[model samples]
Target: MTQPIVEMKGISKSFVGNKVLNNVDFEVLPGEVHALLGENGAGKSTLMKILTGIHSRDEGEIYVKGEAVEFNNPKESEKAGIAVIHQELNIIPYLTVMENMFLGRELKYGKTGVTNTKKMKQLTKEYLQQLGIDLDPLALAGNLSVGQQQMVEIAKAISVNAEMIVMDEPTAALTDREIERLFEVVDRLREQEVGIVYISHRMEEIYRICDRVSILRDGEYIGTRDTKTVEYEEIIQMLVGRELGTLYPERDAEIGEVKMKVEGLTSDAFHDINFDLREGEILGVAGLMGAGRSEIMQSLFGYRAIESGSISIEGKPVNIKKPTDAIDAGIGFVTEDRKEQGLVLSMSVKENLSLPNLKGVSHQTVLSEKSEKELVDDLVKRLNVKMAGQNQEVRMLSGGNQQKVVIGKWLGINPKILILDEPTRGVDVGAKKEIYHIMNELTKQGVSIVMISSELPEVLGMSDRILVIHEGRIGAELKREDATQEKIMYAATGGE
Candidate 1:
């Protein structure tokens, strides 16, 4: 048997008085992919943080290659051959790809204290070649698409010669082809005898890539088992402590007449778009990356300048030139990029929950703290958001909880039309169910929803109608009864 590459024995940690982690044990072998499975707030992240030195364990013993070790900080962990790629890509937007990759550890000019630009470029090219990824090293990081940015992050991690990598939801924003490329990279790393600790909520991905699976429940160690020995359902039960029946609630949509219509919509990014969203119905937009699904939502939400368009709410023409206008017109947009556009990380959960509808929590045109607190508390309970309290900073919450906060913000406004762009992206299964419940409740109240999703199963399972977009135009419209994965993919690919 191969020697263990890393191990954490009896790890215990906490914040203030709360025991976030209690006697957790984790181990990973060289050249193997070890999957960390858990629900939101199950202490997966806290345990990993201890390994990477983001947080020191209150009590624990760490053994690296059968030798005792402790990381004092992230740099120390990196020096010990551990690296991390966060769910949120961490590339500097304005910097070039090569510059971002060689940020702190640049090539020096032979005993001189000056960096060598030519050597850095050459090394970057070699690294990309080694990974079988073709990218322009001089291109600005932000100018690349999300898929390309993710590849750059992987290359950066590998450039440091890391022997162990912690990947946190690496494929959350990627397409099928991008995911395949990532798997190829992982295979190469495994051949190099590098250990990878993979963290994700997608069970299919875990079984597809990992050799062993370790589960955690409520901050305690459950068990580590061979991937082939356990069924997926059993793993999910261990995570959430219950069996999930139907992912989507009952679809009792009334199918009312169109409440909002867009005709001849043209923007610099897209053109000649037309669609109608009906009251008491969920309409899904299906398309590949860069097929203009998100662009349409942004244009409709008044986040982008529209060259020409006609929008009518309730058969009455209205001008939506800004986000405030869109909100006032009963349109609430939940953007795909939650961290960048949805929530203000520095504020409390209560502040973020009340953001879209401060007026509702105000008295005599002045803010009422008591009413705001009450409203936020109610939303927290309704959404099943896991947090210490409403006063906790939004940044401190997990990815799933932050997503709930975004949905709560829009629901607080009580909009008649809701546009959800990848609403369940990067969320855990439990949070996804809660979001589906929220949608069910809203549709029952006559609110319209337009869901934009890359996950075909989610679209078919949840939407009342599906609109497939290709090259900035609608290719086909399928009723929920007639929708299928192949049909939607055919339409999304322009029937090619």
Candidate 2:
């Protein structure tokens, strides 16, 4: 057998008395795409961080090409031929693609202390071309689409002469065509014998690209197997450490009378949209990226201006030109980018939970700590938010817990209509189930929900009715009984 390219033995890491990784073993071989599978908070990220020198392990032995090495920083790890492409891309949006490629390690001109721009651009262009990327080297990072930017990131890795690449959810924001292109790049890298560590929650990608699968459950290594020989259910069971039973819970909410109605809704991004959301119903908005699904929701939530529309709640017309108006009208919106748009990261969990209904927690022109605490405590307990304490910073929580906090904060508003934009976007399966249960509970309490999701399974499984938006128009409205993945895709792509 050929020697492994990268190996970790007896790895363990702890944070503030919490053991995140415990004696976990992971390795990758040259020319192999090794998948690091785990649920959120299952220590996948922590383990990867340790390997990339972003975090120091409390106990472990790391080897590169059969030689022991201890890297004290990310630069050292990169120098040792390991590069990480994080889920949330780390790129300077204002910088040009070529500039970003050689940001830290620029070529100098013969002791003149001047950067060799021509050399950097030439190298970046060659690297991008090698990866089958056609993006212009001089283009600003922000001007490129998500897919193009990801390609630039990969090209940057290659320019650094990285032998091993760790890609975290590389396809999360990519379109079908873009994903295909990425896979092409991955195949080329594999052909060149570069070891790749692929981490993602999407099972289909694992089956499509990975050679070997390794499961981590609650910070413990379960086992590894050849991807081709492993059953899909077996992988799920291993990562979760139990039978999932079902990906989505059974719907039990009884649809009631129409609680909110929209007529001839038009915006810059969408046009002439009409829909009715019933009490105790989950109305799912489905579409491809940039199909205006989020734009419609944002307009309805008063985050964007509606060109023409009539919104009625309980048979009464309402004007919502701002978020405050929407909130006053009993509407709650959980934005798609939770970290940037939904929660205040610097604030404590309790403080964020109390933000939606500050007046309710205040007393006569002054804030009341007792009232605030009581409200936050109720929300935290009700939502099953995992936090050290109410005073803990929200940014400290995991992606799943942070999402729960975002939802819990909106629940504090006691809204009659709730709008969730990609509520389970980056969360794990366990977290996704918890969020679904929460949605179910909300509908049970007579709250109507407008859920916008890119994941078809999520929309089909949870929604009582699905609205497919295509090219800024309502292409199809599918009843719960009629919607399927194929049908949804057909409609979402502008099928008649």
Candidate 3:
């Protein structure tokens, strides 16, 4: 057997009195893609931070190619041929691809302050070519798609002669095509004997690209198994430390008359979109990236102007020209970009939760502290948001907890109809199941839902019916019993 490229034994870490990683062991082979997976607060990131020198391990032995080493900072890690590609990319948007790639270690004329721009550009091209990326070296990073910017980041890592690369949620924001491109690059890296630590919650991708998976729960290492010999259910069990009965709950809520109706919902982003949301129904919206699924929902929520449209709530026509009007019409919207659109990261949990229910917390025109506390407390308990306190900033919570707060904010409104866009995009499987249970509970209470999700399995599992959008129009509407990934993809691509 080949010596592992990197190894960590008896790793332990703590923050203030809370232990995060407890005697965890991890290893990566020269040409293997090892998956590091767990729930939101499962200590995956903490271990990686220790590995990359961003944080010091309280107790551990780290070896690079079987030689013991200690990294005091990220620069030291990179010098030792280790690099990290964070979910939030390190790309400087204003800089060109070449400039970004050669940022700190620019090629210079011998002993001179002047940068060798020509040599830097040439090297950038060569590195990008090695990854099979054909992007221009002179293009502005801001002008490039997220996938392209990610490629630039990878090229920069390769430029450092990195033997090990850590990719955290690399495909969270990419389209299907972009994901395919990233997988191709991973294959190339594997061929070149580069060790990759792939971290993501998407089980499909883990099975497809990763050779082995390691699990952690509540800061303890569960175990590692070869992907070829592991069942996905087993992985979920390791993640949650229990049997996750089913990914989706039963849809027992009975369907009733239409709660909201859209006719000729036309806008620059979409056209002639018509749909009827029956009471207690989960109407799933599915489409590829840039297919206007989010745009249509945004327009219905009055975030965008419609050229011509008519909306009827409970069979009564309403003029919703703005968000306030939509809210008044009994509409609650949970946006796709939860951090940017659905929540104020700087505010406290109570403050964010009370933003939409201001009227409820206020009697006539005056605010009532008692009402606010009651509302916030009830919602937090219901959503099971793990936080230090209600006063803690929303940004301090984990990804799954933050998403719960977003949904909770809307739930406080008690609207007749709820619209969720990419509701569980970055959430873990445990949190996702919680959300599904919550949705089923809401539907059981006769609340209608419009769910826009890119996860096809989610659509098939939860929806009473699925709508496939193609070129900004509803291409096919299929009952849940009749829908399949193949059929949806075909309709999403304009097939009849």
lDDT per residue (tens digit) for residues 69-107 in model 3 = 899999999999999999999999999999999888888
Pairs with backbone N, CA or C atoms under 3 Å apart (clashes), candidate 3: none
Clash count list over all predictions: 0, 0, 0
Sort all candidates by TM-score, best to worst: 3, 2, 1
- For model 2, the stretches where C-alpha displacement exceeds 4 angstroms are none
Model number with the top lDDT: 3
TM-score, cand. 1 vs. native: 0.93
The local lDDT score (0 to 100) that residue 136 gets in candidate 1 is: 82
Model 3 lDDT at residue 228? 100
TM-score of each: 0.93, 0.97, 0.98
- Using TM-score as the yardstick, the better of models 2 and 3 is 3
lDDT of 2 by residue, 1-496 (tens): 8999899998999989999999999999999999998888899999988998889999989999999989888999999889998878988999999888888888999999998888888888899999988777889999998889888888888888889999998987787778899999999999989999999887778999999999999999999999999998898789777888787878898899999999999988999999999999999999888899989988888899998989999999999899999999999999999999999999999889998889998888798999998999899888899988999999999888999999998899899999999999878788888999999999999999999998888898999999999989999999999999999999988788
lDDT of 1 by residue, 118-194 (tens): 99898888888888988888999989877788878878878888889999988888877788889999998899899
